[model samples]
Target: MDHSIGEIALRAGVTVKAVRYYSDLGLLDSWRAPPGHRRYDEDAVGRLELIRRLRALGIDLPTVRAVLTGERTLSDVATARAEALAVQIRTLQLRQAVLRVVAQRPEEIHQMSDFTEFDDDRQALVTDFLDAVIGDDPELRGIRQTLTPELPDDAADHQVCAWLELAQMLPDAAFRATVRQMVADWRSDWRADDLRPGVVAALRQRVGPALAAAIDPASPEARAMVDEITADYARQLGKPADHELRTRLSSLLETAGDPRWFRYLRLLAAVNGWQDPEPLQPIYDWTRTALRHAG
Candidate 1:
């Protein structure tokens, strides 16, 4: 038995207009009955239902037709659609990350817009920006590597945000100049043991406990911490850990250390999945304060 257009629409749980639209597109076949009225077979109901499912998945009319006509298999269409949706999902996620950055730093919104996607050119620009600011110093090569955000094609939400923040920081004139000066000052100093890994490791091992204990920088405990750290540095530099050396080290710490500069490294750690080295900052601060009044 044949069903009228109204019956087909009712059976498919669709509107009369939708049934008519699909019929016009040749997706639903209809025949003229005795009274010249449109009549649809049971197969037409199944066709209409399939069309509805494909449209719900955002498949275009042509692709839907291809599936209907056997030009493409259902699996082929579904696979292609899934890949397209993945691309759209990534685009939306990146947009969300960009907006989050924009909201947090409205004044820097201009810098956030250029990163809708991180392509090779953008990656190269980021590297060049770092190289220009960091200079060609062999001593800082490790630092350059640590600070760069190597964004993968499938970066996570936090990684994307890190990349955006890193990008914005790269072009900042004041941040660049401060970092450059700090590197230069570190290289010029004879007792800048912080730049040496073994000395820093020693400082952290000795000073870390005192900092955590909240020992007063002026107290004997904190003074002992400073003395131990300075002795190690003095041995490396072949100088005595005297009051003058301690004063000069305190002055250098005052000039070069900035918590804001450390934020870049924190962002890098987030992007690269590194163990967070945040505890070192407080230890350094505690040592700096102790050294200031060591004399």
Candidate 2:
């Protein structure tokens, strides 16, 4: 049977005013009563119910009208609305994290300004380091220029947190100097050529068994392993495997093997939506400890 507007409202669990609004919006069809007052059919009652449910989900009236009029399908509208809500939720969560950080570390409140004005300072620091190292060599410069970590315009809470921690760590004068010196050493032709090949060969020929057995870096086996690896590296670099070279190599390994650099790479991988490398710090440290003992 046909229903009056009030009856439709009661059945749809919406106010009479809301039903009238829907009718005005052309979302609910109505027919003339005996005296031309609006009357609705069972279909209109069902349509009103659908509109109420969608409105409860924060769907705007225009979109609800579009869905009701078949200008947009329900599935498409629902998917769009879900995606919009997800973005809103993420934005709110980021704001909460920012506020929490500000409240807990009032001294670092200056950092909050940077979040709004610039990309994370850690990203800038990394960029500066790459530029300094590769600036002179056109071929290397091209590669370094291409190495950008595309952090999101609106990053998630954890990513922002990681960025902040990284920024704080890299700005210390000692840390910056250490990084610069390491980069300079690596840029030298001899050290640059020797790095990957020499390290890999040394590990394979000398430390393979200890690495396989997962020997602790401080263990006696690790010491012998380091000595063998150092000897191999010396031959490869054409340096005498003496006290000075051993000391230099040990220091180089420690600086280059900083956990922050690994962490930076991991975060950069995330920012750029790339696959992260397997962690290398443990192996590097094992190699370092072995070298120290050998020296």
Candidate 3:
């Protein structure tokens, strides 16, 4: 049956103007009426419904036309459209996160720069911290490379959050010095070959008990533990476990005990999604306290 544009639009649940627009676009075919009005065939209603359905899905007019004309299958068009929608959703989510951060910290608005502004200062700080903590040993160097967090050029909201947390930790001078001293002491005593077999084993045997007993590092009990451990270490080195050795080991424990160093590690772990190291401060403090009285 021949139908006027208005009749087709009513049957298809589309506006008259929309039907005319689709006819003009050759998406809905129409013929001339006797009175010079436009007429559409019954098939135009079905075509109008297809166009409406595709448009509702955010498929652009051109793509819709290609699908309707059979140049591309509906499945192909749908797959492409789904991919495009996914990308748009991701962009929107990132924008939402940025806005949330800005709203939460109005005072820190200046810190929110475009992702392109992720500069060398941030990169260098991250590199330096990893080096200080992990050291320059060849084995650790490879681990450092693998664990490095490279801020993306166009970071999403989560990456920005990680970057800000990492930046704050890396810039603390006290934290840097603590890490440096710890690394230096560790390197002086243990080579890569001896790390697990000697140093780790010794620390675990001697310090692990104090750590487990919850002994205060600065108490006499902790001192006894340190003395026992240092004596063992001295024997391994074929040297006397004298006062000098005790003092040196004490210094290592104290430097490694700093909470700020642990804070740095915690921040790095968070940024890299690693499991947190056990809290060592309480045990280390116990060791320090114990060492003072043991002398």
Candidate 4:
């Protein structure tokens, strides 16, 4: 059964004027009552709801009318809207980057177009940081990939914050240099240890359990863990575990193993929406304790 235009508007959460406008546009099915009152088909409420949904997605009146009249499929229109949203997101991200640079470094306002050019290669900044830190060795490909955060067009608030913080940090000259050399030491003379993950893997394997068990960093157990790791390193390098090696290893751990830079890794994980790997700061802390504690 048909209902008056007022009933259709109430059901569709629209005004009576809107229902009449659609009816005037021939987009709604309506009939005249015996008393000449305009009534709409029950299905008009469903159709009007669909029309509103499409309009909210930014579909124009002509396209929405086509959709209602069966000239276009809803699936096709939805896919088009999704693709449009992706493009819109990319444009907004580019603008946000430029504005950030301008705000952070007003002196660089003359070169603001550089940020605009970032649209062509969105990863340029990230790539430079990774190259400076890890170098361009093929052996480091996987680690490099893991470290770079890809902020999607539709990122969550935390992810956006992570990217903003990372972008700010990427331009620091001293931090970049420090991390560059630290990665070299962490990988342990990359020429010999082409397996870049092994040194950290070895350290983590020993320290993870100790950290979980809440063993004192200065305890005998922590000391044993340190001794075992140093021995393993010596075996890998075919060098004696002597004063020179101990001193170098201790310094390396102090430099690279600081949890300071690990903060950036956590931010990277957050930005990329990845599970944060086990934090290595505690591992370094345990090793540092063992080295200082002569017991």
The top-ranked prediction according to TM-score is 1
TM values, all candidates = 0.59, 0.56, 0.58, 0.56
Q: List the residue pairs that clash in candidate 4.
A: none
Kindly report which residue stretches of model 1 are placed more than 4 angstroms away from their true locations once superposed. Answer: 1-111, 118-121, 138-140, 189-191
lDDT of each: 0.76, 0.71, 0.70, 0.74
Worst 10 residues of 3 by lDDT: 189-198
Worst 10 residues of 4 by lDDT: 187-196
Query: Whose lDDT is higher: candidate 1's or candidate 2's?
Result: 1
- Best-first order by lDDT: 1, 4, 2, 3
Model 3 scores a C-alpha lDDT of 0.70
Model 2, 1-295: lDDT tens digits are: 8899889989999999988988887888898878887999888988888999999999998898889878999999999999988767755665666777677677877876564333345456766655554455665565465455554656655566666665555456665666577667777655644456557555555555677788777787777766766677788789887887777776777776787667766776665567886666666677777776665
lDDT for model 4 comes to 0.74
Q: Over 4 Å off in model 3, which ranges?
A: 113-163, 167-223, 230-261, 268-277, 281-295
Query: Candidate 3 at 152: error in angstroms?
Result: 15
